[model samples]
Target: MALIDFSFYSSIYSYNHLFLTVLSFLVSALIFLASMRKSKLKRVNLPPGPAGWPIVGNLFQFARSGKPFFKYVEDLRPIYGPIFTLKMGTRTMVILSDAKLVHEALIERGSIFSTRPRENPTRNIFSCNKFTVNAAVYGPVWRSLRRNLVQNMLSSSRIKEFQHVRDKAMDTLINRLKAEAKANDGVVWVLKNARFAVFCILLAMCFGIDMDDETNEKMDQVMKLVLITLDPRIDDYLPILSPFFSKQRKRALEVRKEQIDFMVPFFEKRRKMLQNPESDKTAISFSYLDTLFDLKVEGRKSGPSNEELVSLCSEFINGGTDTTATGIEWGVAQLITNPHVQAKLYDEIKQTVGDRAVAEKDIDRMPYLRAVVKELLRKHPPTYFSLTHAVSEPTTLAGYDIPTDVNVEIYLQAIGEDPKLWRNPEKFNPERFISGGEDADITGVKGVKMMPFGVGRRICPGLGMGTVHIQLMLARMVQEFEWSAYPPNSKIDLTEKLEFTVVMKNSLKAMVKPRA
Candidate 1:
């Protein structure tokens, strides 16, 4: 009787399994059909952007050259009419060339239009992993890391303490420029030196190492290794080529391993030194590494593991280098092009600092220099798109659906130079920033205008520190030296080639003659 009962139940169970399987497939089929129908009806809702070739989707179509982002986007505006849709690989990017749209999307409704950078190989590297600023998605971990940076690296108190660092770096930068200044018209790549200074100083703040020539060289090599590994190789975009495209991945692993080997020993050495109470005083004074080891400042108890440490150190650099340096370089280029503005800036600096070395304390007093920086920032922001991010909430813009996890960008470069926002958009004028006569702060103009530091929640946190360095270095250098092009305008090449960041096609080689 027991065996007969078991058989009867087993038979019923088999039928039930079959019935469930059939029902599931039928429901799935209905869902699939409904999705297909919905997809077929849906249309891309954006202003007329450039129509791209089918699959590649405007792969390399952007400002191929200089800070004429207005001109670059204007080429499309005539056709697409201010708002336009563009594609980067399979992803869609809406370019808001108009300032109002930028404000509407990126500022007022920023929760729906915040940060995501999915382009290139970041997705592969960090999607499965949880240890980076670049790859961490828009969520708690990002907020945590960002908050930590604010408290430890970029806070007002920290910056006040680091004023000496900037002052020293400024003195060093000026001394170097004066030393490098030639009697004859010897062309120097001013941008190259500026990039090195920005990275070197920021690295010092990040790792707590005072940058000397040898240390700077070592830092440069590490940064170079990182950049080579980050270049956007096309093979990774397509699936079939993925296996063959493992070379970059392999190279990155090897590079990362090398980075770890370099940083781990250094970290341990610092850690041991920090263990000593005497070292704690000198140690906290020594570098950012020791500061992390001491108290649980910034929520993180200690520096990341060897690999993570190196990546974070590298992250401390990332855009902070290329972007600021590029902006400053463009500032120099613009000043060089428009000597009238250059004379005005030099006059202001001379009136304020008066042949004496620009004391770091005096920087806040120099409004025109502040204006020059802000105006340049307004004109030539490096990233046409703010570091891209996906929308985490259902949002609407221009009556279009911004579905959750959909990617978006704030085209600050486009928005900052919009004719409607500025009195004279195309002209390079610094007076636009001097609102309170000569005593106003120009670190950034919020809401009314988006400075290059970016706007709202995901704005560049390092703005104060970053801006000070550029102004101190570049302004001092320009004031202390007389820069002129390698070849006079008739023979000068004005071509521009923008790579990881923008560069003069021929490089900004100029004769650096000492003002004295």
Candidate 2:
């Protein structure tokens, strides 16, 4: 009787377990089917795009094309018209290559199209879970952070206050370039020195501390590692494949830790200075970190934490560094490629400043100099695409449904080179702005003719600062030295490669000779 009772209990236990398993399976199936039904019910008239395969969509084709993603997108533009959709793994990207369409989406309906897409896992680690201004969702947090940065550091008044910072950086850059040219037989790597100079300016503005070359270089390396690790991985789009990218994820975490370790001391230093202003005589009177310390975002009780501070400062530093440096390199390349344009610019600078250094006030008086800088930007905008934007809610753009889940990106290069917008857009002509060829509205406020610095609400907050840096650096470099192509007569190869920004494939090697 005991044996029979034990057997009966064992049978009951097995039956109960089996029933629970089946029930769970059925529930999961129902949920999936319901989700499918709901998705089907939402009638979305998505923009026309190439047919894609199951799960991976057009990712495989894109990967197999062996073309830079930007070039690949450009190739698709003629086939799919101005606006088209691309299914990149599980994520949807709607690319805008037309000026009108970009203006309509980013300007006419700026509010809906201002938010950033969900960052990949690695980016999230560095972005401090979207607490940084650029990565934050379009909301009170983004507004507060952006407002604080602009008012405290990037505003016209505030930028004026940092003139000494710019002057010092410029002097350092000129001295370094001269030394580099002398050391290397008059051949200096343009991008390397330009990046260092911009980084110095941004670093001082960020922490209010002037670090030594070794320390700054170390920090710069950390920033570069963070950028490298943050590059898009397959697992970012397809979470199911994450196990395959374990090494990448691990490296990303390591880079994040390194970034935090390097940046935290700067924050602590600033914090102490804020506490006792007289304690640190070396600290600048103010810094972007100072504003961050006092910032109170809408969902936080106190100011940003140490990690968040690092993220914000990182964004501030990295944001302007690469773009400004790249711009300078491109501008210099153009001057080397077109000697007439360079001569004209030199004439303008000489007439404006008269053998002295190009000051901030002198930039406005030099129209040709401004035009040359503008033309360089129009030809080679730092990045091919603007930061990815996402809609706040499901909306319609140009009669196509734009879902909140999709990443909306503007092809800045295409817009800048649009034939419909400019006369002879392919040619790099600075006279276009002055000779009435085209009224270049770079800000895109009047119209979307050319947007090197982007347009509308979510435009780069450091736009003014970046432009000033590029213009000033170019002016001083031109005024101090006459830049020509390296190896005497070789052409300045204009082929571009995408790095942190779109940089020269053969980083500009120029023979910079000091002007007599």
Largest TM-score belongs to which candidate?
2
lDDT of every predicted structure (CA atoms):
0.59, 0.80
lDDT of each residue in 352-380, candidate 2, tens digit only:
88978999999989999888888888898
Residue pairs with backbone atoms closer than 3 Å in model 1 (clashes): 49-85, 115-389, 116-388, 116-389, 187-510, 188-510, 208-287
RMSD of 2: 12.4
lDDT of 1 by residue, 235-345 (tens): 333232357567767887777666666666667766666566465443336455554443332346564555556656666766477777776677778787877877888
lDDT of 1: 0.59
TM-score of each: 0.80, 0.91
User: Candidate 2 — what's its lDDT?
Assistant: 0.80
How does model 1 score by TM-score?
A: 0.80
User: Cα miss at 389, model 2 (Å)?
Assistant: 0.9
Give the clash count for each candidate: 7, 0
